[model samples]
Target chain A: MSKDYNNFDYLSVSVKSDQLSRILQCYRVLGWTEVKTEDDKRYYDMSYVRLRRPHKIPNKDRLQYLQVRMESAINSLVEIVGRAHVKSTAVISVLVIIFLVCTGLAAWQFLSLNQAYSQVYGWICAVVACASALAACIAGACLRRRERRAAADKISARLKLMQSLIAEAKLLVPQPQNEEEERAGEVNNG
Target chain B: MDKSSRASHSLEDRSRRRRQRFTEDKLVKIRTEHSAGSFKTIFAALIILFQLGIIILLGTLPAFALWWYLLILAAISIITAFSVLSSHRAAQAKAVWVLFVLVFFFGGFIIYFMSNDKYMYARARRRHRAIFARSEKFLPEYAALNAAPDMKLTCSYLSRAGKFAAYNNTKLQYFPSGAQLFDDVIEKLKSARSFVFIEYYAVSDGVLLNRIWDILKQKAEEGVDVRLIYDDVGSRAFSRGMRKKMRDSGVQVKVFNRLISWFTFAMNYRDHRKIIVIDGCIAYTGGSNIADEYVNEKHMHGYWKDTGIRLEGEAVDAMTLFFLRQWEFITKKSFDYSPYFGHYQTLYSPYVVAPYVGGPEYELTICKSVFESVINSARQKLYIMTPYFIPDDSVVQSLINKALAGVDVRIILPSVPDKYYVYLVTRDNAEKLIKYGVKIYYLRDSFVHSKLVLTESCAVVGTVNFDMRSFYQQFENGILTDDKNVVAAVAADFERTFPDCDHPASAAKNGLARAVAIALLRFISPLM
Candidate 1:
């Protein structure tokens, strides 16, 4: 049945769990009013948010494009957040191998070499092994921290871009002057 | 013969015995259910007890003499007769009640009081009315009333009396087979975004329900609002474990008229509607229920032929309302229904679709009226298909009248009946109509579960069968559309079915004893 376009068009968007508030904020500027929010039952890390906008809004294509970009930005932001928790396996592996090699050399000097060389060379190798192990711990922690920082920086940039897109989108779709206008504008605009 | 040949003959005898044993077991089960009896018998027994109490109380009272007691009984009978006369029951039904009252006196009067009391389903009816009233604002007014000029009067009647509006820009798709409808239903459910509302009479445990449950579970997990309502008696095979599984997955479940929970005869009024509304955009309704037999995965009769129709766009709003009305009544909670109604731009279409509902709450039998309207409007042809053919006298008369007026009237019923007693009555009714020049056909080896009525002007496809239960006793929904495409599709289905159906001549068996049995069964068919 055809109705006077006074009705609102609705959309449902799913995003990572903690990101709902920010997504709603951005969507609000894009003329979407948050209707309800639900946590995904299967995916604990995801949540669904339903939003409605005036039907037949001006520049719908541009607004939809911005919405897609905003969603993509949120997706990338979630991936970056996940990436921050990722450990640098390559760095950890290299450090572990170095630590093991030094320990092996120290064992060889202490157990198989002659007494004179064993005392001197064994002490040097033992010190080197301990230092390597300490270095492995320090290097692994530093690598993880650096990766997290880089991920945070990328996320911040993406958030800024998303915010700018929302602003552009907001300008494309005019805000309603009043409640009555908002309700009636959907039909009149088209 | 050799010894091997003798052994083969013995093996054949054993197989034959096993087959006979299986058939005997099935008959025994049916007999057990029949012996348990129907609601009418139980209610009648209760009414007799009430009458006995009144009689004994009057007889034992010291202040009242035997003459006084007799006088009181006479007064009560007179009052009850007046009440029956003033009531809105059909003329024929009222006549039957009057006959019973004169024959059985106080017991019959008490039976009428108990059955006609609005107190039976008062709460449910009140809530349903409220829900429907509240939904009226959310529904946009019918804008294309003149789209189908030929059926304007019927549409107007439904809009005024049934509270259903004619909708345009709503697309209709007809499915000739249950399997195909289900395949499409599964696919459509996969695309659901906001919500899925399901209401059905029966949801037997089978591959069909399992597949639907899988989709519903996944959809619920994805945060879609998935709500299901099934009649407890109809879906008895839907195990508690399955219900818990659905709940655990966040699919909201509600059982209509739980037989054990409700200590009343209201349980007899089952929700016999088959509705599946997906996000207020697409909906499906017809004779098919959520069961294996509907899809022919498992057969109780032989081949099960069920039909369904899919609605896309605005007509779906009415279906959504139908589900919510029942849901609200069962749950006793109101909801903000605005979010579920879709906003769509008006697309131009030639056909007009009006989806309507009927139940005990409405005084008028809406389903019967629609059937009559279609029958009355048919000048050239009228075709009908149903699993059961126990229509009330008015509907039978309408068919017979049309057939006599030179309209080519035909009805197709199931040959392999799920219930033998009901089938006998159906066959007997068919025989009566055949004598009036109405052609009746039985689909051989198959149970046609489709509730369809097609004529030259319009068509009806929904859960409303040509039976008293669907017409008066149960809550039902149907689509009354003048869509040429839909009507043509239904006509085409009937055309294809005719060849497969056996005429009443070969399907009927005449005998005095069987005739007496059928007469007895037909008399109580309305109570059934």
Candidate 2:
């Protein structure tokens, strides 16, 4: 039933069910509390359960504002991810080229190795290959470390935003009223 | 109080404090006003005391003649002291004049008295003849443009030294800026064959100098006689280690008159000339120095505007002599002129380039005479650009009188000046000139440090400014050329520059401020 009603505007209006659910998922993935739905006619109607805007909101309209802010955050994260991917691919290609050059030179030297200079030439080729491989590995490790750091920062930012949204939802929730007192009196009489 | 009012008050207080600090930080004033009575009264009192002493001595001893001689000696000493104190050049010339006076007094008084008038007349006649000779040669160049009759007479008077400044086959190329001149200099240095001689006022260690040093070092290694002479005061920023490095690179270097004693401040006469001679074939002279700032690679005191002339002809011989004279004074070694003379072969060119050197030490003040000649020779149009516009009274009068006679006289100075007080004086002088219908243009982009003067056909571009310092103290070089092409080129550059500048007529100032500026400038113009 929730899935069928989950219609959201990632391009326009931000107060749709799927948008809130995605934010909620981001919060959960980032170890933040999930937002709770409120069920009180005085505070909100059934539409409000779908994360509709309030009629007369006090303070700032932070939910919609947070949606715009989160969109930009996501954009910047995607840009960083794109740049990292490009850099990784560039590094991999350079490493591949260097490895090919080193291996080709090594093979050529090995083939041309004569009776007197065969061992010396073979040693030089081996040393060159080892050095080239070491350099490639170091470059790959550095690129990976940078990519991991960016991912971690993006996740932490998303978690913080989700936590704030859950707090806002708690503020919007209605408290249980005098019906509980009637129930209590009935139990006492019994 | 409101916030703005309180802020303004605080700002005013800060400004007042800054003004006070500025006043306190000023160096002690070198010039002061003295009442005439102070010196006159002192002199009268001293004369009375001296007469009383003479009377007493005559009464005590029988040495009347000796007393009279002593009195005469005292009078001569007083005259010498006054001359030395009043005139800047008098101190140096005093010794020679004193001997003349003494010889006249001691021996053949009658002969001296009789010959003095004749001697003066003969000297005047000789000068007049020299003037006539120079005018006869160069007056035709300005004959058609001679609208002012008095200008011809002034020119004739000023061109007395033109006989010494004559040249044969020559070519002159005027560069509007130091950077352009440096480009030519690098090209010339690259082409130097036997020897490269450079004497500059200032040379600092920087990228431009380093590159020049590199080229010079290479040329030296290739058997070229590379020598350099720089003023000690000018090279004060260069470290000893830097000098050592230059010496290690095989370039012979000499510092001109290194100060050894405090009294040597009188050696304040600097070699302000910028001269470069390559193999006695090509030469450059004018205001540009060998520093990155001059080349505009580094901004020193803001954008640099300068002019230089490259010469290739008999004029190079004059430049060689100019450098050699200074070299002899410093190094006491006379270089053989024969080898250098061989390279001064005449080039068949239409341009008439006359390179001249000037200083107070010379037998004749060539720079002063040339400036006066050019100023007086200007008839239809007189265009001048100088960093410093402090002209002696004669030059100023000539310029003002020419302008009054309806000549299209224009002067260009720097809008953004390097020196504030000097610029103020320059503006003040410009205001006076403008009042006489002279057009004044303040170059807006940067400092216009080029000392350029253009007439209808001929032009003089050089290192010397129209200042007392350049005229009376510093050694300077310039090219006086009658090349129509070069003149037209300079005129075109001036035309392009004139519109972007502010004219004195358009300056925003009150009449009272203008009067005050003029008065202050006139009072201090002599010292400046």
Candidate 3:
């Protein structure tokens, strides 16, 4: 089925909103030109773009494989980022539940018992509940912020790997030195 | 436990394990691959015997006897005979079935009913009618197109029979061989922006299909709607893994009249039409299937000579409709037909292309009627090319009549046949026409798979073979046109092919045994 390339090979891929710019910039290194982009109605943050490149690019199979891996890595990064938010929400919810349980125990001791020891127990329980609430607020703000930073760093590492792949794939795309050579290259690579 | 008892148990376990291994290696694996069909056949036979056993049990009950069972069978046979008499099949076919019913009274009528049940095509017939009814609004009225008298007559007859009409803005390009067709098709497929609808009888995993599939996968990923309809029986060699791979790559695949369906046993009616419609603008249809032999990458029966035509412009709309109508029938799903109608304001051309479809569910054999009309109207020259020449009595008679009237009628057949028995019958049929001055030529060293007919006024091209199955038992599509350039191209191809053809004064006299075999084959050729 494989013959000398006589026409352009087209490709289209969908990227999340956060990764679209980086993905497009990296693909340009592999000789793909963006024809158009359309918003994906199924997902608010997802959009698809159409691209075409000369079918006879040097080492096309290798470049195409790399492009697929790049897309896969981006998808994995997005999933991990999504899971990070879910983890934060769960952590905060558990803390809030602990705070509510402590408050309930403290109120029971204060209302049902009259001895000093009971009152002291209730006060200690109330202080513990306050500390738990404080912990919940700290985790809700600082923990989530730190997790976001960690997710960002993970994405940055993946982007750097993609850039490295792009650097290697760009070498496989023909880079003609002269106008005549460029025209000839188009004929040879298309 | 005693030591002897434990030792005996271990010995038994080892022997049993060895026996299991032997069975797994020999019986299970071999039976699954080689004997699966026989197993199914045996199961079906058992079911039939069980039913008969119950009937016999009933016969043994009080006041029941063999005479009563015989009487019931006779009644059923009579009803089947009457239905055959009233059916819309050809006279010859009907006569054969009627005789069969009378001669083999026990099961012949039952077989006839099973094969030709009135309700077998109900689902397909209903869906086809609905799609065509909806399609009528999308196809513009072309009653004002300038057309020759004969072309106009033929086109109107086709339009009245189905949901196809003539268009003046369509451009036609004919490829004399499958290789050229594939090259053009691949280019057109690469440019598809919206959707690609492909319907073919045979699709094997070969070079040609792989090439087209590569583009199709890419286009599908690009969000283009890509759907394919292939006949399960025709594409028997298309492996399950290949089909799964296509689906995994996002190509929507549908099997037409699946050969192994429990719903109905009406497997005789096949989707034999080969069509490719891209974005509702460009279309290709012809004798070429998606296989290596089609494009000559593999020599099937000597050189595989096939032909196809590419249509660009409004005529493609009809091809798209043909694909969609079949898709809806097989999948039981429908979509809006408006988006697929090509609206190209093509430059003016003198040709009037009328794309039409034919299937078994229709009361009339549309392909046969149109071919007869064109043959009956030929004034000067008539040329026909078909891989198989086992047409029905009417078409053979028409060819004889035209030849007798001094029309230069020539039919080119394949010298190297892919099916030996069918080829013998084809030769016999050709010899029958030779006595009436119709010239029959066998393309030397090549199997001519092109289905085309040309008269002085118009030409017909597509997947309809000049055989009984195509005429009466398969879905077919073709383009009937009075296009001068297209007709000339086909005529030129025929003339070019004549040099490599063998024109015998008469086919070498067959041996007595072979002659008898051919005669027997011809009697049942309608079923072949």
Candidate 4:
């Protein structure tokens, strides 16, 4: 018969509100108790959830499993960070609208001057059109860059915490699935 | 039990019963609101019929004055729309929107001209967009604003000059605790000449509140036009006896958007502003409400930390305007409040002070814009202190971007949480921010309720918390200043109140609590 493992430890993580509930749900899905908070615990000391490893498994086994679990979670967050690089649809739409408006206005003016069709006026129209399009493109790029930076920053904050939590979990638990650990097994887990 | 112990227990019992009664009343009120909403179809039918009747009845009037009829109908509809928007009655809001949108669609130029005022805020925003286009150095364009010395100067100037008179002669004093704040408010009320206006989110039954009431009564007895407005929900703890005494002493008391007014539909919001404007020359605002704990007379969670500011210049005019505007709204009285502005000081100083208000009624959110601007503009450091740190996407984006851009961003939250669930949210944000380039600290052993944002050159402190409700829903007011002293004082407060932070390396106990909080927050995350 296997010896029962009773002396279980906890992993406490402070998460952003947006991600806290989801992380807690994740812990629950992993067969840990739902994150239950204390009445007096304020966030100044930093409170979100205390993720506990499920019991019955050997401590060594639990640690290895949790390490893998945490790594995957970290990877998902990293994926978000990777995908956070996005162009601003609003800026792009605005640019397209401006381009159309400027071109349409210039074309209409060109049509109105069809009979007069002076070479100087034609040259002036061409110059104005090129200048307007260039300016729009430049401004649009700047706006796109700014939006990208903001989105990156937001995603990175989430990514940073995920990395930190993984590190914290690593410090708390033992190494995962190494050849030495496989030989040691339940003895080391105890 | 001894007589005193029994008496205290009896008092507790009475308060408990009172609380239950209030809860029951609130339930009944909500049910009634829902019932009223069910009759919207009938109500709409009646309104349309009556409107048609009026058209037919007034059709006999001169053809030239036909526009006037539509104008009157439009005015009535606008009021109805505003009421529905403010109403706690949910169905009325949707109906009003539908009705108005329909009118705009089918109504010719006559109906359009008559009802266009319904979209005044939207139209005004569009117009102001063009105007603001000319002035690119707004509060939101921080990077562009900080790029050059000349641009930075222009930014400060523009910040001061937005939608209000830019006060140069203003002298602002910071009161770090409720002791100084309440004492100063009392002193200002005592010196009231023409009138005294007070508005607050919460007015609890306490020694500090009694002191405030006494001061208001004395001023009212001396013929000061004392007008007071308090939030109905927030001020529910106030004993009825105190209110009666105030009225008996001749102080005009009114509640802002009571439950009965919930039918006005905009009832989701409470007036979160804590403003005391005296004689139109002096004003006070901050996060502190009328309570003993606010001043640390009686501690609930821990030491209660708060902040307030006193203004004495053109900034007062802005506050006076805010008070008067709200007064007219709540009381439905159309008195010329111009007399209050008469007392504003004319002395010019170098301090550029801009005081502004934000609410759902405005097309542009002033508080959000200002915070975004300061966050965007932070070159060296960004210091923020708020109890609730639930920021919307834009704010989060700006904060993260600023920190990533090498700005030293620091935030302070309370170690002692007043609300556990909200505290959870705050922590969640804090952890993420800490992981980012931001350093998050807790104000050790105290609940810090000061809503402030301070940069190297600019500072803002007032009722606007860095939360969704304050930014998007509630009526909030604050003062923006490039004054060296105010900025320095704000920074000093931040330096003094850095709370003990729990490092991520530390083991957290109580999985149940975190799990429970997570579960509850998950269901209500969208609402939050």
Candidate 5:
């Protein structure tokens, strides 16, 4: 049999300080609170981040409640990422449209310059316009690529965090439910 | 088509031979024990199994009363305890007394083992996540260094080899013998500015160590943070006064593990790693320990051959971390690691040096994984040098596979036995492995105390012995480098040493008594 679900009241994990900060952001958004922070002398690179669930949770149904919290939080993350993904896609599409518009204007300018022996100042203006537009197009493409990568990384990290939380829940949750324990939780809830 | 048919025929022959030999080996049980306790042994095993079955049944029962379950458990536990203790009555008096001692006897060991594993596992999982995502936002340089997407390192992220981060432009200077190694160590000690971390398995009070002691004392007096860690069993002759003397001179001293008695597995796991990091940037590690014999000044074995490496660059950060971890383990106090950082200056050298450290604190032996990779990747040449050659089954099969795939497999062992019983076990492996196309050579010039593994691509040199102890029990560390010069140096050493060795006659010529003795010895090779 697995360990009694009641044994796990909190979680302590080792991570870099920066990572702990990001993880803390997620937990606080989920209504969880930081209960402790520890840095063992030996592991300077890794610091222990301890978190506690807000509000008092009784022994029974702790696993069930925690599981609910994790599922809800995971859904929230998925929604957040979905919105962010859509936002990024829209931004990239806008950039691409701008790029195409700028490229067309530059092509038109180049064609006119090719057809007519124009004033030196007009010719300089056309060349500068083409150069700046090309620059913007390249910058937009690079930014789009980078933003996509960042979005993917954020989603992956959050999913991994949720997976770990669910594993902890599984360890705490007993396969067979206790009727007495369920009644006790109901009483506490009432 | 003809070549493919020949290959098929060879494969069939190898499979047939393997089956035949394994069948014979399984059936041939050496009957060394008397027939008196056979029935008792069988009954005891059965009792243990039956108890396990009962516990599982009770544990999985459908919503049973907790009180009744407790009662049943107590009754059965008492009954089984009495039965088991009855058999061990010759070693104990009262069954209750036996039970009390039993609860606490292995408690310390069990707790240490479990907590250490959990702690390491937690750390490994974090690193694994970082690796899985290839996200440098969390650990940028560390992740990049260890992330070998191009290298065929099919090692688990939990293992040392897998978790290792390779550093570039690290200077790797090879020391072919102990003479150069010791001399260069003192030179680096002379240049020590901030800290000196030294750990060795065998640190005898001899000519070499005394000279090292004088240098260490001078450095300590000069205000260097000199810390020394030595194994309790390997350096048993290390006097309390010597330790006190080092302490008095401002040199910090820590012993690896204390022995409860002369005959006990209490201190079975040892700190066999030989590491010396001066100022955190310059480090040295290899098979040669601190003793006169290692330097060949004392004639225990004539011209004792060993190897060491002088590494300089970012890779020393890994070595320094290894030392600091050991220091923390022994001292039970965390040392400030900030002072050791930013001191290393990475130069422009083309070497990928990765430090691989493993011990009994972890079950996944990184050194063994490394050896398997080296053997599996070898296409042209595979050379090995060790005093002992008692390999486990996986290593044996890997070697066989490589040899059949046309890889030149050569291993050098000591003709002069520093350990006779261990030599017997090594002989056991040699006798078996040689039949499958692996060449075994005896180093007749002297005892080779070096631990080396070299392939066509890379080489591993450090303190890992080719036995179960080094792979599974003791703490070991080595450098896996694809540096061309370093691999060439190791190969050249093997080339020079091959002339001094002679291939033994085939194991088919061994007598029945010798064969039986080898089998019995290999059975308990782990304890040895």
Candidate 6:
């Protein structure tokens, strides 16, 4: 067989001696144990594992394809999560700005009251500052709670997508079969 | 089975259920919280806060040490607080007394209290009696055929004023929004004969305003006397260059009470009046401002609702006089009213329109008086539509009393509030009104900025809100019209808006959430 040929792996696997044994070995290597074979043809007809790629000679191209797909999926997931994080951070920044401005204004007013040196002025300034602070704290707390809830929602959605991907991966691999016939002689020996 | 695998399976299942439940609960909470009725709870809390502030101020001041000074201060404050608390004839008087006390202290208090008694007694004996004596002079004697007592009283008052008040012959048309009104105004400018006078609270330059400005320039070029008066604070966004451009085009513009220097807090009193009189024959008044959003042509706030009335009648003379007085006040030009009122004509019109003007500088709050008169005169039905509904105690009590007296009193407010605390206060007041058998409807589509009042046959439509600002402080105007068709038209619009709203049985229907809003708003109502 010409090793550099594009179709050489398919041709060599078909013509190899003990083709059925080679297919069974490929299934085992791929962690698929629910497939069966009759004569020289391999078949895996199960509801749990539908589509399968036939066994072939191992090569760099096939390995590279799988690796690229995994990388793309990981990259997309990271980008989506990153965008959500950015949005949350931006909202938090706005909240912080408002809080700082309110605090600064209140402090300025309070200090200005010191120039007045009147008890009534001081009390009024203190009341106003307290009110502003209370309002700011309430608003900040509400915003933070909303952000946390949004994060929890994002995480739950991501987890669900991950579970779906795992199920899809399981479907892509071939299964093994005919274990009962192979283990008959071993059971008698035990 | 492995312990870790089994535990992980159970954990995943539990988390999935929890997440689903959490989202569903959150949606329900959001929906309930978003309803318009939630504002009531917030307003109740604000009222409580206002009460607490009054108490604290009263208790903290050194009252015993300065008994006379403190007593006068305390009396004015208490009277003001009581006015805020009660629905009585004393509300306007009390508010005036509060301002009087602030200005002259003890001396002002005595002067005001004594003058107030004399003022009421004199007005009752002199004007009231003279109005009745001269009733047959101006009003058609047949006017009393189906007249209510309040109408009869108003007719008599107008009859006396008609003897001296200049009358003009003109046409009248009512527009439901600022957009349509402005379009008509631009057309009127094209045909302006002498002078064009404009006074408004807010006049922002935008697409619509720019178009109108072009017409105003053309009119000014044609030897038409053009004058514009806008409140300084209200038109804060307008540029100095824009003013110069208008002046360069031969148009004279005056800013009412320009905030030039510090210690001008007294200038806080705004000319909230909206009036446009063209060549002394045509005039316009209502709640519409010169903002693009008012026309639905701009996307500032979605669907702004407003109304304006076009007047060309004896009432137009009254409006012209009102504008000239303000023009004199702002420009210091001693205007001989002869030019404005000497050429008045009486146009026999299908609609009987009377324009009432009120301001803080006036000895009496005419707006509050008109409100009391209108509220007291309701027979079959009363309908109101306002953007803000934070009324002083008297107005609120009038509404409650009217509803309880077997009158069909309905109020329509915006479902989406423009101001948060004002919305809350409105909701709180609505809740109280609902308890007194008044039907409250929220306009679900747009913000209803039109300040209008409709009884069985007549209607009052203008820029005055039901709040203390409109009643006691700001300059406001309204047209009292005896037009059954206009009243019916407005009432029908209210009918179309009512069904889209959601009316809660009470603010307490949501229990704890309502309680929290009510508690919070009570401490902040006065500021609202």
Root-mean-square deviation of every model: 29.2, 36.0, 27.8, 23.6, 37.0, 25.6
Taking the tens digit of each residue's C-alpha lDDT, what string does model 6 give over B1-528?
A: 899999999986665454322211110010111112234334544665565455445554666577776676756755644543353334444555555456544344434443332343344235333332433233222232344467656544544433222222335676766666877787787888888889988776655667678878888999888989998766664567778889999998998866543322234467889998888778899998765556543433334667888877566766776777677667754535556543434666554556766765554666766666787788889988888776767778888899999999988877667776677767777777788888887754356788988888677888888776687667888877665566666677566556645565555243687667865654334223
Evaluation by TM-score, superior candidate among 1 and 3: 3
DockQ of each: 0.00, 0.00, 0.01, 0.01, 0.00, 0.01
Best by TM-score: 3
Candidate 2, position B200, lDDT = 92
- DockQ value of candidate 1: 0.00
Query: Model 2, stretches more than 4 Å misplaced?
Result: A1-190, B1-165, B506-525
TM-score of chain A of each: 0.66, 0.47, 0.68, 0.42, 0.39, 0.38
Candidate 3 chain A minimal-lDDT segment of 10 residues? A1-10
Docking class of predicted structure 6: incorrect
Per-residue lDDT tens digits for candidate 1, residues A101-121, read: 878888988788677878788
lDDT of 4 by residue, B195-259 (tens): 88889988877657766776777788889899889987667666678888888999888998664
CAPRI verdict (incorrect, acceptable, medium, high) for model 3? incorrect
Looking at model 5, the pairs that clash are none
Tens-digit lDDT string for candidate 5 (B1-528): 699999999986665454322111111111111112134334544665565455456453632646665555455555545644554221222333335434433222222233233343455434434332442121115332333342335323323333556667678998877766987897778888889999999777655777788888999988999999998767755667778889999998888876432222334578899999999789999999987667654446434778899889877887887787667666755445656765787587655777768875444677777787777778898899999987777788898988888889999988777777788778668767787788999875367889999988788899998887787768899888878899899998899778758886676455888778876676556445
- Candidate order (lDDT): 3, 1, 5, 4, 2, 6
Error of 2 at B315 (Å): 1.8
B82-196 in candidate 1: lDDT tens per residue?
7777887665556667766666553556556656626666766777777778888866675556554557878878877867888988889999878768878998999998899
Report how far off residue B139 is in candidate 6 (Å).
15
lDDT of 1 at A122: 77
Question: What lDDT tens digits, residue by residue, belong to model 3 across residues B285-355?
Answer: 99999986776545546567788999988778778877887887778767777777754536567679988
